[model samples]
Target: MMTVTRPLTGAVVLSCALSGIAAGAPARAADVGRSATHRVLDVQARRAGLTTAAGGYPGWAKTTAPAISVRRSAAPPRLVAGAQRGIDVSRYQGNVDWAAWAATGVTWAYTKATEGTYLRNTYFASQYSGAYKQGLIRGAYHFANPATSSATAQAEYFVANGGGWTADGKTLPGMLDVENNPYGATCYGLSKTAMVAWISAFAARYKQLTSRDVVIYTNSPWWALCTGNSTAFRLSNPLWIAAWTKTLNALPGGWPTFTYWQYTDTPIDQDYFNGSYTRLQVLARNHA
Candidate 1:
C-alpha cells in the first residue's frame, strides 16, 4: 500500500518540460493550429471569474448533444484489502435503482457530469439525486476534451452544471476523468507540455470554484504518456487509478498511494475507495 503525506492545500505546478518529449522537437502541425484556439478559450475563461456561475461563458452557454457508449468487462471484480466499496455510473447503466444499489453496501459513487465543453450526461439528474437520496455519497466528474476545447472552459462548464460542491456532507468532490480521448487522437492531439498545462488549468479553476481538490481518474500508462509522468498534482488532489488487473503493479502521478482503485468495469464499473468506510465518509464535502 502507498502512503500519502502531503496536505491538500495549494495548487501544485508541474514543470512544463516533459522528460520524454524533447524541448527542441518541432511542433506538430495539429497542435500549432489548435494552439490559437486554445489561447482564445483560455482568455475568455480568465475574463469571467472562475467562481462565477457558468452562464454566458464561451463553453458554458453552448450545448452539444453527445452520444453515449458503455463498455464493461465480463470478468469479476478484484478486491483490495481494507478498502471501502464504491461505484461509478454514467448513462450506460440507464436509470439506477439507487436503493437496491445502496443495499449492496456501496458507500459512494461518482457519476458523469459534463464532457468536453458541450455534452452533458442525459441521466445525470436521476443518477446524481438518486444516489444522494439513497444515502450514498456521490460526486460528479468531467470527461476531458483537451483537443476540442480549453480546460478552463470545460472546468467552468462542469462545475456550473453538476460538479459544484455545497459542503452538505453528502457531496463528494468533483473528479476529472482524464483517460483516453473520445475524440480523434490518443493524447487529445496535445503536446506533453500542453497536456500538463491543460490539466493544471482545470485543477486550478476547479479548486478556485469549489474550495476542494478534484480527484484525478486515469490509468498509469495514460498518465505517463500524456503528462510525462509528472507528480505535480500529488499534493493537491487524490489519485483514482484505473487498473483492472488483480495485482496493482504500478502507480503514477508522484503519489505513493492511491485513494481509489477502479479494479473492474464489469457489472457496473465497481471500485474501492482505499480507506475505512468511516474515513470515506469523512472525505465527503459536507461531512461533519
Candidate 2:
C-alpha cells in the first residue's frame, strides 16, 4: 500500500496499492487494461466525452452498464438455498407498499438516502421507516458522485442525513453505491488510482463516524473500470454486488463471495442475501 496526501481535496489521504501503476500516476488508458471490462468501460468513457459528472440517482447504474460488454448467458438461479430475499428502493419507487413487498417474501431492503454531498432522498423517512415497519431488515445507501464532491465529505453528508447505523436488529449499516457515472465520465473523471483513494477515504470516514464498515454496492464492470479492481476494501467492507444476471456469474476481484447480490432490475432491483434470516439479523447487529 502507498500513503497519499494531495495539496488540495480536503485531507482525504489514501494508502491502497494498485497492480501496475504508481499511487500518484495520472490516470490513462494503459493503466486500466487489465480486463475486458476495463477495455469496454474505457471505450464508452471516451465516447461519452463528458466534461463533468454528477447526480447520485440510486437506480441509474443498470442503465449505464449495458453499454459495457458483460453479458452473462447463464441465468442465475432465482432461489438459492440458505439465502434470504431482498430489494433496494428509492424515491422512484415512491410510496412503496412495503406491506405488499413483504407479503411477497422480501425480508431485507436498502433505501436511497443521500447523493453526493447535497441531495437527500425526498422520501427517505417513509421508505426507511416503512421497511422496518413491515418487519424487514432495512438500511440506507448513498449514491456516490465521486466527481461532484470529496468522498469523505459525501460520506459525512450521508451519515448526517440517513446513513447512520444502530445495533438494532431491524436497521442495517449504511451502504455506498459506487458505479458508472450516470451524467458524465465513466470513472467520475478520476484516475483509477484516485478512484481507489476516494472509496478508501469514504469507507474510512463512514466507519469512523458510525463504528461500522459501510457496505459497498457496485457492479463488476464499473468497479474494474473506475477502481482498477483494487482489493483494499475487500477485507473491511462487505460487498453488495450488483449483477443483473439471473444469478451471480463472475464477481469483482478480491471478494471470494458476495454478502448481497442484486440479481435483477426487473420487479424492482431484486436481491438475495447470501445467508439465512438469522445471519441477516447478525449482519444488521454488526455481529457478523
**Highest lDDT, which number?**
2
- Tell me each candidate's TM-score: 0.71, 0.76
- Estimate, for each residue in 113-208, the C-alpha lDDT of model 1 and write its tens digit: 877776666668988998999889899988787877788898999998899998788888898988644223446678778898999999999989
Model 2 lDDT per residue over 1-288, tens place: 233332212312222223423244234332121111123334555433211122243333443333334434244324347799988876555567777778878899998887786566667898899999989999999988788789989999999999999888888889999876654567878998999999999999999999998999887767766777778887778888876555455566477567888877554668889889998999898846
lDDT score, residue 216, model 1? 88
Clashes of 1: 2
Candidate 2 local distance difference test against the native: 0.70
- Worst lDDT run of 10 residues, candidate 2, spans 30-39
Model 2 misplacement above 4 A: 1-59, 62-80
Clashing pairs in 1: 169-286, 169-287
Highest-TM-score candidate: 2
TM-score of 1: 0.71
